[model samples]
Target chain A: MKTEMAAIEIRNLTYKYQNAEAPVLQNLNLTIEKGEFALVSGPSGCGKTTLCRCLNGLIPHFYGGELEGEIFVDGLNVRETPPAKLASHVGLIFQNPENQLFSFNVERDVAFGLENLGVPPEEIRRRVDWSLELVGISDLKDRAPWELSGGQQQKAAIACVLAMQPSIIVFDEPTSFLDPLTARGIFDVIAKLRRKLDLTVVVVEHRLEALAAHASRLILMDHGKIILNGEPRKILAEAAERLSLKVGIPSVILLHRRLSKLGILEGLTPLTTSEMAAQLRGVLNRD
Target chain B: MIRLEDVGYVYPGGVEALRGVSLTIGERSSLAIMGRSGAGKTTLIKHLNGLLKPTSGRVTVDGVDTRKATVAKLSRKVGIVFQNPDHQLFAETVEDEVAFPLKNFGFPQDEIKARTEWVLELFNLTRYRKHSPLTLSGGEKKRVAMASIVSWKPKYLVLDEPTLGQDRENKLRLRELFEEFMEEGRTIIMVTHDVEFAAECGFDVALLVDGKVSALGSAREILSNVELLKKASLAAPQMAELFLELEGVEAQPVFTVEEAERLILSRLMSGSGRP
Candidate 1:
């Protein structure tokens, strides 16, 4: 298999917030390929969001953490790069849309990042239109962020980040506040963008079922360390029990495992609801 | 009991949150309110406890109209737990946080202490009774918020997005607590988007869409209807959806996992295998 080039490279990265007892991230090493859709999931406060901030140059540059080792995003060392400079190559979307959106209107919100980058008015308008269209929130251009739904506001935040024309985008639990249908819709948009734009996407989310089918790879974090990194199916199947113990398992996977334990489900490990249904039907038919 | 007759709420900023909607929730029955954002689930919930008054129409709780009742009076019977724990928690310690509501209700110090101790023990937070609320974890904060409300022993409990930040273990524990509350005949009206949790809790389902009650029925009836769920911007629980797809089983939607298992088992035993 051909190896895709790395868009993000972390070498023995470690970081500790000032006045903390221990480091949040310790000796973490990872390499994310360009245009790959990766899901970073773990228990809350396990340093997943901290990792994201580190990737977008918010750690040493903006947060003033005790940083060690190196993080290079698109060949630029994050330690040396300022957040404003890194904003052009890697866009960061926070978990709370309210924190990211400060503009009076949706269009202005999307254009905020571009304006900071000193993009011309014509190009900024073009980029804002393109980004809004990508997130399916073009019609909400004139509305206040507070007036929009939680899902719409989140999409607008993503569009705001996308307007900067970043090659990589990192989302911190973008759907934590949304309903399941809306969450799925947001994931669909993310998948579409990943396919159409060749953008590297790293999302830290707990809704594994929504993203499991679309993510190119799944990275499981625990105690601020990446424990399992591989294709979704392989990682889920191999680390079933440990995964359940570390972080909550999705309902379908839990059901599949229970059935398997009872000798009612056999063949082909199922990681999703559809796959589980198919395998379950086959078992009943054989009986 | 809580009743809404042609209720509507237009925010001061001119946003129509809840349209003219009518519904009644009987005492001791749990109801799950499901909807997408901007569907007015929150707005409808707020009306139950008199947090927000209807712009048109009436909202009554326990024979008292919300518009005519003080928030304090309604709060004694109706307790609401917001999504963010920080919003409700203001006390320096967990014990005080749980007792704050009781003190506001004018309970004696001895009675408040007793209730606080009971709730702290009930939620297994006794070890952290003296700990600062700000130092607690997200799940801990949630427990404190729940403990505060449950300590009051309100007749009706309304929880908004109870499982938003909870882990699987915590979620399961919450289900157990809700079941206990139901067994004791306390009314629980939860506003949530978690289909699996909703299904497992065995509550009657209410689908709120565009500030209206789009669909209202038993969990089995509402969740099995895929078309209605789609229109409400909701998804059927994975197990419920899977059971519906089975050949011999005529998609009788069930809320709880145990119910789904029992239905599937009965169909299989009757020689009606997968269709």
Candidate 2:
């Protein structure tokens, strides 16, 4: 029965920050099955960060907000659990890598979470090495936080979350500060890790092109409500029609949309450059 | 025009961020600096405003040597918007924030008020004029940071990663704003990792690799070169990649969706449409 439970379950969730005029998230309900990778995105101030806080027990516990609803993570009710305990089940990586990583070296930063959970020294050491190798940052284990580049620092941050061995991971625009190549590298690491570990991952990002290729589901939020949730391709095609949504449609899909309107590649939307390229070759080769 | 004569920069702790980089930026021109995270893009822009003096060479903005000029003086001609809005936004109200720079520049009270209102409307920040800048969202705060610097209307506007947190609407607005600036004969220098946005802006590009200018040219020439882009740890725009993947497509420099569409339509017309 426990194995059949969903990785995350939310029901009738409404939350408001302290001294706010109205609720930030209003009657939102979502369920993410085990091993499902969800990409949550919207304009800034769309309550994506607030939703992330609710998952790791930060809303009712740390933020001291009015949380009226239910959230279950790894079969544990988030509101009933303390953040310190929830840290073991759900890991939340912030947008800024500098905010979470404070230890002198990468190895120490990775070990901090396990140490706080009262894991023994040997276990911490083993977990740190395993997570560092998982992210391919083992060579920078001895380097200080400031000594690493932005991409390297973000990798270290992800390694810190991985060392906790959580069942679910939530990233809040982790690649917002990264460049195209570096951001792609971070996304590739995430995709590889999810495959290798079968981890349930939820990411909040505006750069849809980088993450859409790997996401099993796409969740679009607006004005604190889950406006659209479904397959990435269908949702993106729908989003393309509604200009008011202001979601950044990947360029390939935009090109696909343009070609489809011209009676070419109708009813087909490609997400990646390669996918669009293959389709373009078919159109070009046709005589 | 701004000129860098063999400029080099090294931080206090012995981090060699920039090496012998010599380039000349013509007046009324736009240049987008693209590179990896630690490739010294920020360090290179800082030299323009006298924030970081060159260690080995010289930087001159309109014939004024940066080393001899104070930041305050250089700022009058070069207004820089930092990457993180929180670093520069410390005002009680968005209106006051935009006016602060004008006041510092010794604009008359009437002119300051007019300019503040003008820029507030320009950024669509009039609705939040009375609100504290700290209370705004990340995107609004970035706009306020931009409004503050732009209020002064410096001859050279420097933006560090202007598209970091912006949405689609804001990016479109930015394109219009850059066009308006260019029409006024003002130069815009932006440091960014957004290759697509840079391509849309049609900016001249300088690719940095390990604090050295590895490649410099028009956006089409620099961004369309896959091998050169890889050297800077970057990739070509999606459209360019798409056309490149289609063998013998002959769309050598398509960077945006519109450009790609036009190219594809032409190709299809020549190919006599799909079967």
Candidate 3:
């Protein structure tokens, strides 16, 4: 049997929006293998969102932009396939939840994408229920979308995309509008769902502290190109050394770097606060 | 000074947003209101101006009851940059959006033009000054919304989640701007959930839980107490947590990297020499 192909592939991709002076995405190349959780981050206006839009055929089709490159999502050429056709394979969650949610109630909103794709009623119901529970928002099924808080509405948006049962999901700054606790809860939900579904996940976020530990790979974009892409720990360590990436290194990593420079602590860099604390505890008691 | 005396707000849908909350925000002070979403942080700030009057109690801004003042009249002293830029941005161009507030506040043509240019440049929006506000990205629109309000130079600046969607560079810029604004003896009342930002700014924090002011103290006191933060459904800053989790490391309240460094250095001298 042939091994499963990469979940997403892009080669020398460059896209320019309508009436734009320069290309937002310039000669970008990325490949996300199956079931890989990748986190993409960069400074504001670094073409992160534009790259996400390209994953599901929104570049040349919906936005009417100049596109030159090849993109394959689950072996289907994104340039050839329309967004509607790619919906089942690749789900895109917008940065703002308000942009995606339109239905009156949460349950109906979760069911919207499935119903549009002509999925059977019973199947839609099953998938909607599964997704709502997966995102830990089953209690919000009856509430109106407008009544839910920013965090809840974002959960609902995730459920809407999850209900489609896509093999890959791209979340664009899903927690930008949320509080720290709520943002952590959102990341937890994403990790849980990715593990449960074995889906490839790509999250574009600024809260690297919360996401760096969960991501299998981290990709940093700047001025419309991927400047760094590799293991999250390695990339984050490198980015911390450079300091100019300004990708918002987690506080723990910065602390680790400071101690290492002082010749106080050494070894693997800690990604989370707890990890750093654990390492410090070992060294402090080593006397 | 802004004062809320047992303020209670019941929404039109009969949802009680705020309940018997009493607080005072003095002039030239920086106050950060933090709570989980839907905990009435926004509702409490809405009472600062006359945007939402308390249903059961009174709110006074600088000795004048909000109930007795019109929103337009109160707006001269208090300007709010709402959380969602889409709600406040209505002008065609970015420059016009920043100028609209100054114009509405009755600034002269030359003053409005000068102030608008100043804020636009301060926010680094000169390149997009002619572009429509709607055409900008989320972070850019947020800056425009903020620039529009700050252009008026209100005595009290109210920011709702000012750091949301901002990257590191912009967040640093905002911290600098807030420092400059507070140095001029103006007050800033910000409702945010960014613990790191709050700790960095050294703002006095008020923890709101279910529309009630549960705790009020300095950012050092409030943010370092993991128990208090947990009660409000928030986590203490990681720096604080690191010190807490490490055993036998008695230190003062640590929230930022610099403080943590100092504490660790003192401990390192006692425990072991530097490698």
**TM-score winner among the candidates?**
3
Superposed model 1: Cα runs more than 4 Å off: A1-5, A60-62, A262-264, B84-153, B183-185, B254-271
Tell me the spans in candidate 2 whose CA falls farther than 4 Å from its real position. Answer: A1-5, B92-96, B108-137, B248-251, B272-275
Native RMSD of candidate 2 (Å): 2.7
Clashing pairs for model 1 are B199-B255, B247-B275
How many Å off is the CA of B181 in candidate 2?
A: 1.5
State the lDDT of candidate 2 residue by residue for B187-274, as single tens digits: 9999988888999999999999998899999999999888888888787888888878874435478888888888788778787543
For model 3, the docking class works out as medium
**lDDT by residue for model 1 (B150-251), tens:** 887888989988876565666776787787777788899999888877877778998998899989988878877888888777888877767666642466
User: Measured against the native two-chain assembly using Cα atoms, what DockQ does each of the candidate structures obtain, in the order listed?
Assistant: 0.39, 0.52, 0.51
Clashes of 2: 0
- Per-residue lDDT value at B274 in model 3: 25
Q: Each candidate's lDDT (Cα)?
A: 0.81, 0.85, 0.86
The residue-by-residue lDDT of candidate 2 on A1-287, one tens digit each, is 13357899999999987656678899999999988899998876678888988899988898786889889989888888778888988999876677788999999999998888899999999999988987678998988888776667878999999999888999988876677887888788788778888899999988898889899999999889999999999999898888433688899998898789888886467889888877877777877
**Cα lDDT tens digits for candidate 3, B1-275:** 99999999998867788999999999899999998877889888888889998999889999999999999999999999987788888988898888887877789999998998888887878878877786566777889999998898899999998887678888888888888888999999999888988999999999998889999999998997777887777777888877777743344578888888887787767875222
- Candidates 1 and 2: which is better by lDDT? 2
